[model samples]
Target: MTTQPPHASGANGAAIDLQHVTIAYHRRVVCDDISLSVAAGSFTVLVGANGCGKSTLLKAVAGTVPVAAGTVTVEGRPRRAWGRRELARRVGLLPQSNVAPEGILVRDLVARGRHPYRSALQRWSRADDSAVDEALAATGLTAVADEAVDRLSGGQRQRAWLAMLLAQRSEIMLLDEPTTYLDIAHQHELLELLGRLHAEGRTIVAVLHDLNQAARYASDVLVVAGGRVVAAGRPAEVLTAQVVEEAFGVRCRVGTDPVSGTPVFFTESVPGAGG
Candidate 1:
C-alpha cells in the first residue's frame, strides 16, 4: 500500500559529511572523534538510549550546535562556508520544541519558511506564495491552512510545523524526536507521511526512540551509544538482539514484523527483577 520514494542509498553521494567531529553541550563534550555521512535521498534515523547524544549529532549537522572540532561538509563545501540564509535554504531543522506564535494562522506560520528566501528590505513574491501552497498540499494541511496553528490537534499541529519546513524547500531535513508527544496512531500517521516525502527524494535525518518504528521507516539506521554511533546499516543488519542489548541495555527478542517485514524488538524479563 506504500509507494516507494525515489531513493537509493548513496546514489547521489554524501549530502552531509562529518569528519572527526566533536559535539559538546555547555562546553562539555558529548560525542567526539566521530565520522559519518548522510546519503542523498535516504531516510536516516538515529536510535539509541536516552542521553546518548543523538539529538546533539543531528543538531551538529544542522549547524545549530557548535562543532567543537573537525568539519561538517554540506554538499561539497564546508558547513561554515555557507551564509546563514544560504544554509537555511539547503537544510532545515525541526527541533523537538514546537511552539507557534499565539493565534497565528497555519498559512502565516508556514509562510515564515520563506523568510530565508527574502531579506528584510524585500517583499514576498509569487514564488513564495507558490512554495507555501506546495508545502500545505504536501502535508495535507490545505484544508486547515487558514486555521490558527494552536487551534489544531496535536497531529495537525505537527504537520503544520512540517509544512513550514517543506516551504523552506530544503533538500535535507533534520528532525529531533519528531514523534515525542504524539499518541501511537498519530505517530504512525506522521511517520507514514515522512515516508511519502522521502519517496519524493528528500534526505531525512531524525532522532527516534522506537526501534521498531525506526526500522519500519528508516532507510539507514545509526545505533548510538557511549557517545558515538555504534552501528550503522540497514535495520535488519544493525538492529540485532545483541546490538539492541548493548546500545539500549535491554535483553530482547528481535523478529521481523509480519506485515512490514522489518525488524521488531520485544523486551525480556530482567534478571532478578520479579520477586
Candidate 2:
C-alpha cells in the first residue's frame, strides 16, 4: 500500500512542481503518480534505496527524461512550453559522472556552460568570459583555470563541474549522487560548497545515498520507496527511526547530531527492521 505523502510546498513559491507525474524506462514504470514541489531556494535532498527512481525523478525535472503521464511545471510554466536553450538557462543538471574531453583545460570546460546563450552566428563575448571567470573564482578553480580537467583532484574535478553549472547561472540545480567518489573530507568540502550555494538563494535538489549526510545538509528530505515518495518534510520530522526502517529495511536508532543538531542514526542489524 502506498501512503500518499503530502504535497511539498516552498515558502517562497515552487521552483519545480510535479503533478501526478509517472516516469518509465523502456516501457517499465519507475515512479508512479507522484505529486511533489521543490520550493525556490530550498535545499531538498532525495534519499532512497538503490533503484528507487530518485535519479530518474531528477532527470524528469531537468527535461532529460520524458514522463509517461502527467506534467512537470518549472518556474510556474509547463516544462514543454520552454525552448531547449531557455530551459537550459533556467535548470542545470550534473549527473553521476562527467568525463572531460582529453586534455581540455578547466577554463575551456567551464566555458561550455555559456552554450545556451550562443547562436549559429554569435561569437564569444566579454559577458561569456566574465561568467566563466566568475564561476572559476567562485569555485576556487581560478588558480587551476589553465590546468587540464583530468589533472585535478577528485574534489577539484567535482568543483569544476559545479563551476560549469554556476556559469550557466541556473536558478535550479539538480545533482545526482554528487558525492559518489569523494572521500570523507572531500565529501564535507563539496557538501559545504552546496550549503553556500543554497545560502546564496539558489534552489538545490540532489540524490544522495547517505541519509545522515542528507539529514545534516538538507532543508527538506524526501524518502522514496517502491517507486513512490513515502515521506516528505524537514529532516527532524521525516527521517525518524521508523521511517528509516521502512524505507531501507535497516534496524536503527535515531539520534541528534551534537554539532549540527540534525537527526542521526545508528544501525543495529543487517536484516529486517521491526515495522
Candidate 3:
C-alpha cells in the first residue's frame, strides 16, 4: 500500500516531486531535507560541485537508493506504490557510466528498454518494434543499428544509450552527467538533443557539472551546496556569481551568453596563485 500526503499536487503539474527527503549511508547523512520538483515538460538542471549529493539525489528519485526519511512521488503517487515495471514505464534513468554487453548489437542493446512493456507470454509486438526503430532514428543511429556497441566511438556510444532510454518512451527522464567523457562538440550535441526532447514534452532532470551548459539548455536550475538547494529558479535568476562562488569555492564572473542570453560563468585566477 502507498502512503500519500494530502495536498500533494505540485506546481505546474510536476512529474516528479521529492518532499523533505533525507538519505543516509551507514548512519551518516548524505542528503538532508531536500525538497524539489520537476514540472512536466520542463528541462530542469541539478548543478553542484563534486560530492554534494547530486548523484545520490538522482538515484533516490530513480528508486535505486532508499530514502532515510520523507517521500518521493511520481504524478502524486508514492514511489513505493508503483511496481518495478510500472515505474520503468513512467520514468527512465541514465547513469553516468554504463557497461555495454560485449559484442551486443546496438539494436539489441536498445531493445532492453522494452523489457518493462513485455511479459513472459507476450513477446515483442508491432508497437515495440516501431518504438525501437523510432528511437534509433531519433538518435541518428539507424545506420549503426547493426554495429557492435563496443565498436562505436564515445559520442556514438552515448547516443546509443540515449536511444535505449528513448525506446522506453517514459514521460520523465533522470540523467546523471549524460555528457561526461565526451568531447566539447559531442557535449553540445547531447545537450541540444535534450533541449529538443524537452520541447517535445518530455520532462528532463539531469545532474550536470558544467554550469554554463546547464544555463544554456535548462529552463530551471537547482543550485545545490552542502546537501541543500541553495537556489532554484530560472537560469538567469539562480545562476549568479555569488551562487557559483559559494557552491564551487571559486572566484568567477557570471555573464549572459551572447547566443542564448543564458547565464555564463568565467573563472578568474588570482595573481601569484600556485597549484
Candidate 4:
C-alpha cells in the first residue's frame, strides 16, 4: 500500500526533507539533529571534510541508512510510509562505488535499475526497453552496451553505473561523490550530464569534494561540519571563505568563475601559498 501526496518531479515542494534527522552506526552518531530541505529541481551539493557525515545524511534521505531519530520525507510523506517500489520510483541513489558482476554486460547492468517497475505478473515492456536504451545513449555508452562492464575504462565504468541510475527514472537523485575515480575530463563530462538532467527538472542532490565545482554547478550548497549544517544557501552565500574554512579547516580565497560567474575559491594551507 502507498499514499501519494505530491510528485517529487517539480519545483512545487521539497524533493527530500530531513527534519531533525539523526543517523548513527553502532551507537556512534554521525549526523545529529540535521534538518534541511532540497527544493524540487534544485541542484544541491553537500560539502564538508571527510567523515563529516555528508554521505550519512544523504543515505538517510535515500532510506539506505536507518535514521536514529526524527523524520525523513520525500514529497511531503514520511519515507517509511512509502512502499519499497514506490520509494524507488521517487528517489534514486548513486553511491561512491558500485561493483558490477565481472561478466555482466553494460546493458544488462543498466536493465537492473528498472526492477522497481517490474513484478511477478508484469514482464519487460517497450517502455522499459526504451528507457534502458535512452539511458545508455544519454551516458554515451550505446556503442559499448554489449561489452562487459569490468573491461571498460574507469570513466566508462562510472558512466555505466550512472546509466543505471538514469534508467531508474526517479525524480530525485542522491549521489555520493559521483565523480570518485574519474579523470578531470570525465569529471567534467559527468557534471555536464548532471547539468542536463537538472535542466530537465530532476532534483539533484550530490556530495562533492570539489568546492569550486560545487559552486559552479550547484544551485544551492550545504556545508556540513561536525555532523550539523554550518551553512545552506546559494553558492555565493554558502561558499564564502569563512564557511569554507569553518567546514574544512582550510584557508581559502573566493573568486568568481570566469565563465559561469559563480563563486570559485582557491585554498591555501599557508597565507599566500597559491602566489
Candidate 5:
C-alpha cells in the first residue's frame, strides 16, 4: 500500500492542493502519486489525451472521487476535514454533464446552488436571491432565466450550469470539459465567460482537451500522460514540441499563435501513416 505523508501548505498559498495523491477504482489505479498545487486566482488548465486521468484528478480535487492515498486540501485545510456544507461553500464543481429534472426552470436550477447556505428550517434569504440573480447576469443567462434547462441549446445549458456554480459562490471553480459538445463560437463564448470570472479573482481549474484552447486561455498548463503529470508550468514552457509529442504520441510543431501570440501546435505530417 502506498502511504502519503502529511501535507504542508504551499509557501506561496494555494486554492487547491493535492499532495502525493492516488486515485483508483477497485484495484485499477487511475492517477498515481500526484502532487499538484493550483495557486489562488489562477486560470489553470489540464490538457491530455482522453482517459489520461486528467478528469479523474480534477474530480479527486473536488472531493467527488475518494483518494486512495494522499490528501486534497482547500485553502490549506484537508477537504474531508471541512464539513460538507463548508466544503461546498469553498469549492464548486461544474461537471462535464449535468442532467437536471424534467422541465426545470433555469433560475430554479441555478437557485439550487444555494443549498449549502440554506437549512431545512431556513427559508431563502435576500442574499441567496442576490447571488442567483448576479450569477444569471454574469453568465448572460437572464435572457433564458425562465426557460427550462432541457429546452435550451448546449451552450446555453452550459452557461446555466455555470451560473449555478457561480451562485454557489465558491472561491475555487473546478470545471471538467465545460465547453465540450459546443460549436466553435459557443466554445469561445464560454471560455470568455470563464476568463471574466477568473478576472474577478476566482481560482479556476479546468480540464480542456483542445491544446490550442488550453494554451490560449490557461495562465498555467498541466500536461498529463500515462496517469501522471508529464509537464506543468506556464503554457509556453509546458506546451513544447517535445512535451506535446511525448504526451500525445504525435510529432508536432510548436510556435506562437498569430492571433493570441500563445503557443500553437501544428501536427507534423507523416506520409502514408494514415490507412
Candidate 6:
C-alpha cells in the first residue's frame, strides 16, 4: 500500500467525536464500542461491506439513532444537547433515502435545506436566496433549477440532494452512500465535486462502497467490519491487502493509482470459487 500525507486536524480540532458508542437494533447490537473522531474541515470516508454498520454509524452521529452505550459530540457539545435549529446549523446529513415532494421544483427542494434559518416572522431573506442560488450553481444545477425533481435523470436528482446539503451551509456534513445509483462518470463527477467542497474547508464524512473512490477522494479512511472499526487512518495505511482479505474475505491486489497516487484494489477470482 502506498502511504499519503497525514491530514491536518481541523481548525476546531475535532468536529465529531464518538466515545465508546454502541448501537443496537431490535435487541441486536449493530455497532459495539466504536470510537472515532473526525477533524473539522477534513474529508473522511467509511468503507465496508453491506450490513457492516456504516449507515448506522452515520445515523448515530446525526442524532437519528439512539446510542446504546456512548456519547456523540459535535464541536465539543453533546449532539443530544443541541436544539434542532442549533444542531442544523452545525451539521448536515444526507440520508440514503429521501422522499421528494410530488411535483416539487428543484429550487424548492434545495430551498428546504434553508428551513433552519427561517422563522415564522422572517422568511426567505436575501441570505437564504443567496445560499440557494450558490448551492444550485455549485452543483451544476442552475440550468435546471426550475425543473421538477422527478423529471431529472438519476444523476441530476442526486446532485439536487447534494445541493440541498450545500444550501444548509453547515460546517460538517454526513452523507450515506451519496453516489448510490449512478454510472461511473456520474460517480466520479459527484466525488470530484465533494473534493472541491472539502478543499473549501467543509468537514465531510461519507459511507462509500467503492474502496478505490474512497481512497482517491478521502483524506482519511475508516474501515469497519462486523460493526466495528478494523482500521482507521490514511487510505494507504488502512486499505492494505491483508485488511481487504480479512474484512471482505476476498483475495485482492493493492496498487497505487498512477493518476492520483491513491491505493487501488484489483480483485482476483480464486479457482473453484462459485461463479
lDDT of 3 by residue, 1-275 (tens): 11112222345487888899999989988899999887777899999989899989888878999999999988778999989999888889999889999999999999998998999999788988888998898888999999999999988998899899988887788999999778999888789888888877778899999988998999999998999888998999988888888888888888878998878889985435798
- Which residues of candidate 5, in runs, are more than 4 Å off? 1-10, 269-273
What TM-score would every model get versus the actual structure?
Answer: 0.92, 0.92, 0.93, 0.94, 0.93, 0.93
Q: Write the per-residue lDDT of candidate 4 for residues 1-275, one digit (tens) a residue.
A: 01123445323478888889888899998999999888888999999999999988878877889998999988888999989898888889999879998799999999998988999899799989988999999899999999999999988999999999999998888899999889999899999989888888888999999998998899999999999998999999888889888888889889888899998888777544575
lDDT of 2 by residue, 1-275 (tens): 11112323334389898889999989899999998888887899999999988999999988999999999998888899989999998889998888989999999999989998999899999989988998898788999999999999988899899889888877788999998777998889889988887887778999999988999999999999988999998999999988898899888998889999998889889684365
Off by over 4 Å in 6: 1-12, 270-272
Q: Is candidate 1 or candidate 6 better by lDDT?
A: 6
Task: Quote the positional error of residue 16 for candidate 4 in Å.
Answer: 1.1
Worst 10 residues of 3 by lDDT: 1-10
Q: Positional deviation of 23 in candidate 1, in angstroms?
A: 1.6
Identify the superior model by lDDT, candidate 4 or candidate 5. Answer: 4
Task: Give the alpha carbon lDDT tens digit for every residue of 124-200 in model 1.
Answer: 89989988998898778899999999889988888888889988888888998888767898788889878877887
User: 1-275, model 6: which lDDT tens digit per residue?
Assistant: 11222333433588888889999999999999999888777899998888999999988877888999998888888888989888887788999988798999999999999988878898578888888999999889999999999999988998999999989887788999999877899899889888887887788999998889999999999899998999999888899998887677788999999999999999985546887
Q: Cα-based RMSD of the predictions, in order?
A: 3.2, 6.3, 4.8, 3.9, 5.8, 4.7
Candidate 1 clash pair list: 5-199
Number of clashing pairs per prediction, in order:
1, 0, 0, 0, 0, 0
lDDT of each: 0.86, 0.88, 0.87, 0.88, 0.87, 0.87
Q: Which segments of model 3 are wrong by more than 4 Å?
A: 1-12, 270-275
Against the true structure, candidate 1 reaches a TM-score of: 0.92
